[model samples]
Target: MAETTVAEVMAELATLEDPRTREVNEKHGDDHGVNLGKLRAVAKRLKTQQDLARKLWDTDQTAARLLAILICRPKAFDRDELDAMLRAARTPKVHDWLVNYVVKKTLHAEELRQVWSADPDPVVASASWALTTERVAKKPAGLDLAGLLDVIEAEMKAAPDRLQWAMNHCLAQIGIEHAEHRARAIGIGERLEVLKDYPTPPNCTSPFAPTWITEMVRRQQVE
Candidate 1:
């Protein structure tokens, strides 16, 4: 791929637009979906287009924002800027992308998580829990897992909707990754009835923490 300016990339994005994909994406919390494959191609070609990312993120176009999240260097923004970005995430899909691709990928992630987890804003707290889950899955060292489970057990039932999703995810990750916490996490899930009534697809395990944890363990065993 030849070097391409941000303008050229934006033009390419325009050409790749699919209204049908946009419609489906909006149903799933995005304003648009310029195919993921195309986004990958562009990201590969323009790795860490930080300047472009800032401009694209400001546009707030969902497709452009997805590309922005992909191309931005994690270190490009300081904590305040990242906090603002998290606050700007207006949709769940965008928030998830920012958590996974931007915030969790940063060197400053742990520091930010500590602050955000304690924040009063539900979106900020949700992002913190998302990062916490990743940390639990990959590197459990130094994390106060017991404290996390205590909070989840106490507050999950009354958490804001987004926070509840992430708190449940954290619970599941704890059960899957830390054997000591498995039974305790499952007990909490049973008590809270987390996602017990949420619809699950055929062949998919329930998203309730215990069942979700078991499904993860089963997959790990197969792998």
Candidate 2:
């Protein structure tokens, strides 16, 4: 992996005033992994570009990287920017990490719901740990889940057997978070059970099974 210091990353980011570099940074931003220290330094000098922020929208890995940076140095990002980064993660690890460390995490019902409604992935899946209230608000219940499901389903069908498992994991999260979609996942799993699946997904290697639908599903159950 390429190594960079906090100062270096900041300097590189500073020189990123060039539109191409900035655009390149935005395009490849999602691939930067676990650089909490670096992101914090950048957030400390938060950029004022509206277009820059829009670029990172809904990107889980890049969002998580940014979230880690801000959480490590909460004062760096504005309250709204920090919240936007957190919402971008929608990942369980990033969400819980923020809740536990950032605010004594004593969020009221609606606040937590807004958090849950974040985009799906390991980020959103980990939200099970955030179930602090009797009725956990569902953020994405009315979301465009159908579209997300369709995207994954098409990928699964189009992909080769080697890529099938990887696609299943992505679909699996959608299945649980969106209950109506779970039946499709369940149906696919039933078929896969007979077909005997193999290989894992691209970003994550989660499998396809009844229990594999995940905590995101189970949490939404009682609510």
Candidate 3:
């Protein structure tokens, strides 16, 4: 596909303003019926249009939540709110868990670190998602590597098989990002046997590479 630009995305978003598109989308409002792939595209596009994303997150909380669960919606929310949600979460399956995950992927390194430092959830396991937990699977750098290690270790002790898949997903993204730093990066060198040669989503951009970060995500697919 040719490169998708912010303006192109805006054109599509503008369509949402159209009564027909909105009617179609609204008609498909059943949580399962909503086009998650389209929403992921919305999230990916939002990565570039921060101002527009902020307005969406602030002005339409329900729409934002909808985008998050179906689209990685929280990436565009205010940083303060993102951090607060992470630190204050009582359970991994809280109402806004997906929002926090999207935000984790979208945050700057320092801001992401603050989230890791403050995050309290000990272990997270999601069969469907890679790791929607705050700072574990998404943040690029400046995280408490040691603390993350502890959490993963604890997770392994608690349930090795399940957490191992999440670990694999995490390592895959890391490998794709800092190809140069793979040597010094903790666990980057260590192979998570379960995750070894984990398949990259053929249809979606590889999650590890910033270069591959795009204005759309193929959510209809499963890697």
The true-versus-predicted C-alpha distance at residue 33 of model 2, in Å, is 8.0
How do the residues 1-223 of candidate 2 rate in per-residue lDDT, one tens digit apiece? Answer: 3433444443454443345433544453333333445555565665333333334333344433443334353333444654565556533335445545452333443355456534354343233223321121244544455665564455456454323433455456556655667787667766546223545566653465545675456656768
lDDT (10s digit) by residue, model 1, range 11-90: 88999899888888888677775888888798887887788889888888777888899888887788889889888988
* lDDT of each residue in 10-55, candidate 3, tens digit only: 4555554445444564543322222445656777655544444444
Candidate 3 — worst ten consecutive residues by lDDT sum?
211-220
Q: Sort all candidates by lDDT, best to worst.
A: 1, 2, 3
Candidate 1 is scored at a TM of 0.88
What ranges in model 1 sit over 4 Å off? Answer: 1-7
Deviating ranges (above 4 Å) for candidate 3: 1-31, 38-64, 68-77, 85-109, 123-165, 173-223
Clashes found in each candidate (C-alpha, N, C closer than 3 A):
0, 9, 1
* lDDT against the true structure, each candidate: 0.87, 0.46, 0.42
152: Cα error in model 1, Å? 1.1
TM-score of each: 0.88, 0.32, 0.35
The predicted structure with the larger TM-score, 1 or 2, is: 1
RMSD of 1: 2.3
